[model samples]
Target: MNSDWLAGGRAELAAERILDAVRTVFIDHGVSGVGMTEVAEAAGCSRATLYRYFENRQALYVAFAGRETRALIERIWRDREVSVDRSPAQQLLDQLTAVLAEVRKTPHLAVWFEPANAGIVAQLANSPGVVDALAANFVARFRPGLSAPAAGRVGRWVVRAVVSLLTLPGSNEDEERAMLRTFVLPFVLDEHTVID
Candidate 1:
């Protein structure tokens, strides 16, 4: 029951509350339109308190993106219904496709994919520690022989491709899947990896 521990717990809760407010605001106002003042108002906290939790709008957005990315990764792994016998390439395709579907299904996360907000989302997506970790982890799990740097590169590429598709979707899901198989798999998977 230390005072410092209590303060720390309160701070963490406040930060989470602020993020929840951000989710609401982002969905209502769009990621590009929301600012610190708006977030503070939505969170029922002063601008100073909001700043103490998140230094700037970009910082808050990055934090939100990081949180969503982790959730998306967990959901993908959890909901995976593919058989163990599937090839690594096939599994990766399913995983990436699920990622796109999940983002589209989540309103706050989907807003970032809108043309106006996509640049910001892309910036965060390409950042080293954000979605890259999730992507690299997925790749490493499916293709365990890949080196860390190589897996990381594939991870970044997967993020970039997902962002691209989100920004400018293909004719349909069928076309998108075909594109991933033809363009993405060849580069992401090992040369020896078969895609049956």
Candidate 2:
């Protein structure tokens, strides 16, 4: 019951509240439609308190996106572990399935898929740390011996294709995964025809 400890605890609580509010707002309104006032109302705190934690809407958006992306990477890593008995093809297929499932479940991810939110995504695209982290995660999961460039290109294609499928109207995840298996699994297992 020290006064300073109470003050710090209150501050931490407020920050968490604001972050949760921002996340909800982003999910409901996407990036362009959300504002500080709405975030403040969502957090049940004044605009001043919101500003204390986040400098501006863009900053909050970036922070929220970063948190969501980190969470996704963490979940994928947690759910997947390469085993000695599993073939590289099997590992890649498993990783793809898990990642697609995670993306479907994560709310904020829909914003990035929106055409109007392209600018926000472009900002993240330029971040070297994010790129490196993504590459490392892919390399670790697929354990592919391909050159970095080749891996990067193929990974991008697979991820985008998977995202396209998940975002489709009334798409069945299980069906899509099965379809992807027919296409992706074959390419990974055989070097005869790379997917063009």
* Whole-structure CA lDDT of model 1: 0.82
Q: Using Cα atoms with residue i matched to residue i, what is each candidate's TM-score against the true structure?
A: 0.88, 0.62
User: Any runs in candidate 1 off by more than 4 Å, and if so which?
Assistant: 1-9, 191-196
Question: What local distance difference test score does each model get?
Answer: 0.82, 0.65
Which digits, one per residue and each the tens of the lDDT, describe model 1 over residues 1-196?
1224225557768888888889999999999899998998888888888888889877888888888789888988999966879987888789888888888888988898888986787778766687777788877786777878878888788778888998898898899999999988787776575322
Best of the candidates, lDDT = 1
After superposition on all C-alphas, the RMSD of every candidate to the true structure, in Å, is 4.4, 5.5
Candidate 2 structure quality by residue, lDDT tens digits, 36-58: 99988888777776788889876
How good is model 2 by TM-score?
Answer: 0.62
Top candidate, metric TM-score: 1
